[model samples]
Target: MDCQGQTIEVTEGQSCRDVLSQAASGKTLKKSVACTCGNRLVDLSAPVPRDCSRLEPVLADSEQGLEVLRHSAAHIMAEAVKTLFPRAKVTIGPAIDNGFYYDFDFERSFTPHDLEAIEKQMAESIAADKPFQRKIMSRDEARKFFSQQNETYKLELLDELDEDEVSLYTHNGFTDLCRGPHVPSTGFIQAFKLTSVAGAYWRGDENRPMLQRIYGTAFADRKALKSYLAHLEEAKKRDHRRLGPQLDLFSFSDEVGPGMPIFHPNGALVRTILEDFETKEHLRRGYQLVRGPQLLRRDLWEKSGHYQNYGHNMYFSEIDEQVYGLKPMNCVAHMLIYKSALRSYRDLPIRYFELGTVHRHEKSGVLHGLLRVRQFTQDDAHIICRPEQLQDEITGIITFVQDVMNIFGFAFELELSTRPEKSIGSDQDWDRATTALHQALDSMGLPYAINAGDGAFYGPKIDVKLKDALDRTWQCATIQCDFTLPHRFDLSYIGSDGEKHRPVMVHRTILGAIERFMGVLIEHYAGALPTWLSPVQAILVTVTEAQNDFARQCASELHQAGIRVQTDLRNEKLGFKVREAQLAKIPYILVIGDREVQDRGVNVRFRNKEQAGTKSLSEAIEMINEDCQEPFKRGGMRYSFSN
Candidate 1:
């Protein structure tokens, strides 16, 4: 075998090194790796069979290499935990984005002290540099061994394994049931930190025993870990659940039901601003905004195939012995609308937009403040186009998504999701839709990942995930190519050749949902919404009773100038008023006192800023007007909205 310029030959059953040594004049150097067997990376010194591909080692710095390292770190963490807590039952441990987590079913929840102790144990384990050794065993033997060892979880897991043989990993005499390609030694995990403790059901089923999940992050070096920890702290400070109530934006009530969010006046105002902006934008893009019922008969869902595919997530009701369901999606209703009229090929790209509200029965345990709510409004659209125009229509939707996301100064990544196992579409239909999505993404030259089998049951989809100020990504937009819904609803259009053909449907959303977007914004800006979306653009504060009229006049003038403004005529110190406005995240505060009234100017205080400045009332209005007009737009903008 020859690689690049190197020539190598292997004798039957000889290791890679023997061949390299014979190929090179005693110059071939040995390499190091995590594993090498069956796609498992290992040390370079490890023997490679004559049949081995014996490919060059991928360095730890490579993207794929880091994944291998992270997986090793997970094993180390599990080993440390088992060492610390002997009674704990280990389940599955896997690597995730930026880190890894392990689930353990223990008699008691792991407290903060337990986590700290676990961390210490992990550090010690890493320092010891114990080798991660793997051993294979037959299913019956493995089951018997685990049962004898009092590892009920392992026995339960082994029972589900149909394979004749399975693998086990051991570190420091603490062995776990795992199929591993872990790093050679614990010393390779130089930078790692345990992050959070959360409760999860065993195998993700609520009916199963609850397990304590411990999350941690690992990087190749200490610097990376430090930087990640800093980002985590910043993210905590900007958590929407914390900032939302502090800014008086929104709240969730137990009485209203879990996952149901109640927007305060200010929060509602922000949502209204988004709705107005998108509604106008949709009109400009030739999309007709439409309305649909929040709840419909179950029969409609049955025809759309949603009742069969996603009935579990749907909230069904029995009214007069007839079943009804709250709509979990808007595509079915939009398809019905398209079918209402006989469409011509000229109306191929019939785009319909709606701020459609939807409901899903998300598990109570996963009910987040607003991000994963059971009830939320989607900025949904459906485009019915000719088969020949599928690619163009999809590309148009991608462009529209980019333009809308730009409004909020969001940078996003894209993903293409293919068909799932339980999907409804035919093979030909799925292939065409998936191809169209891929072509659209490729045409746009956007970097994307393929989420295999992650699309909607009805179709393939392109999901756009926005990266916020903290670089955290949220799925904020989706463009789904659906053939099932159109067919189910019997949608058709007259083609150019004067023949009727089924119209291709593309379901899309610029902002996935109003409530979720607002939540994202709260976290992105740390609850300080830009002036354009602020409930009040500016607040006019009077220094004293003597300046009350002047403050009101300033506010009225600003309001007449098309700025959202209000006056705090209460007798209070200018500093107190400014502080109150800052607390509300108001963009600007105009302080008018006897001095300002006599001068016919106003003192200005920017939110979260200590310094104040004085500007002519007209000058302040101009400053605010520029800011409010581009609330969604970033750069060179300022506005104050609070009193």
Candidate 2:
């Protein structure tokens, strides 16, 4: 067998661990919890088949290997929970992206004290060095065993499976039903932590019994675990919900309803800046702006396939006893606009953009502050083009995404999501859509991964996930290739042959939801936004009321220069005013003291508390102007002040 590119002779009855321990070069058998044998993942103790031609050890540092470790950690956690509370019953535990969570049918919710005790017990189990032994049993035998153990959740899961054989793993006098590939022993879980606990429903069905969920994470070593914990700490401090209100940008009221953000003056100004910049950028790229009604007839939505596929997430009203659905998407209105015109292939690609606000009946449980809201605005657009123009349209949208994300100083990744099982389209249509997206991505040489069966109901799409300062990714942009909507709406264009040919639609969004984007921005910049994006770019402070007139004059001059300036002419001390501006995250704090008034200049301090020295009034205006325009250059766009 070839193990890690080296030839190793394996006896017929020897296990993978047995052979690898004697021949593997870099990895120890203790760290190799599993191995991939001819494309199948198996435990290290599995007997190497005679026909096996290739094998690769799964190491602790690799993603797959970490998943194995976390999976075993979940089992250890479950064992610890059972030991602490004998009445608790075990359910499913799986490794997620950052950690693992196991849901349990406990009589009461697990508290922080319970988590602490569970962690203590888990530490004991890991230190005991108990070997994790795997066993196989017949379905009937497993059922009888779990039934006698009173593990009802496992029995329910077992009853749902059709396989005759079942796998089980055990350690520290505890066993659970699971597929094999655990670490050789409990001591392998060296760097682990129990993060938090929450309530989750079994199988995500709200009608079912609720269960307590224990969340935890494990790493290959202590250093990695420490770094990850630091990142988590920083993320908590930079959470958008906390920063939004603290920065005086936005707020949410229980009386105003959830998921609807009440943007203060500052938040509104920032949002306007983003929208205005996007408008100019879109118009420069040959996009026409458009708008549609907030609610449309239910029959129109039905014809668009949204009524069937997305009805659960939509809100409906009755006017004159006719049902009208609140628009969850802007594509339907854009489709009607396309069908209203009849043209030759010359108008092949017509791009229409809208900063459209939409409403979705999001579940209360999933309603996060701004990230997952019921009402939000989208930088939405729809492009209608002939079949021949499909690839170019897709490429153009991808470029649009790249340029915009670049302007915001964000690094992004892409994924091509294919047609889902619940989607609306024929196999031929889905294939053609996927091919167009694939060809465009390949032509541009843009690296992207495929997410199978995660597309919109009407089409396949390119999902752009942008990384924030914390290295966490947010879903901000998406480019979709849609053929269903045009066909359903009977949208067509005249071809050179004088026959009506169906046009394809491309649905897209740059900054997916304005609320979510702003939330991300607040956290990305740690509430210290750029001068161009800051509502109050600078605040003028006076010394002992002597320079109040001078401060007012300076503020007015800056305001006339189109720099957002505010005046703090209060009887407060200069230090107090500066500290308030700094806490509010103003970009520039201008100090107008007696000496600064006589010199006809002001001292500037940046939000970072760095002193920028004194400059004349005109020079200060010019400096702030440059600061505002410099960010636009990141997207290669040149800006000039108003004439």
lDDT: which candidate is best?
2
lDDT of 1 by residue, 1-643 (tens): 5522465654565544444455443322322234344455544434665445544544454565567677777777777787888888888888788888888988898998988999898889889988877788899888888887788988988889889999887877777787766666777788888899999988888899889999988876688789999999998989899988888889988798889999998889888878877787788779998888988899999998889999999999999999999999998788878878888989778889999999998887787788999999999999988888889888888888877777688999988888889989799999988988888788878889999999999899989999999888899899999877788888898888999899888888889888888989999988888888888778988877888777777777887787878788776766787788888888888887778887899987888785458889998887877766674444332333433
CA lDDT scores, all candidates in order:
0.81, 0.89
Which sections of candidate 2 miss by over 4 Å?
Answer: 4-13, 49-51, 638-643
- For candidate 2, the per-residue lDDT at 502 reads 94
Which sections of candidate 1 miss by over 4 Å?
1-40, 43-46, 346-348, 439-449, 495-499, 566-576, 608-612, 630-643
What TM-score would each prediction reach against the true structure?
0.90, 0.94
Model 2 Cα lDDT, one tens digit per residue, 1-643: 7876678888878998877876676546657767888877777878887778988788887898999999999999999999999899999999998899999998888889999999999999999989889999999999999999999999999999999999999899899999868887899899999998877778877678888889999999999999999998898888889988988889999999988899998898888988888898899999999999999999999998889999999999999999999999999898888878787788878999999999998866568888999999999999999988999989988898888887778999999999898989899999999999999999999999999999999999999999999999999899999888888888888899999999999999999999999989888998999888888889998887988888888887887888888999899977888999999999999998888999999998888999989999898888888887787787778554331
For candidate 2, the TM-score is 0.94
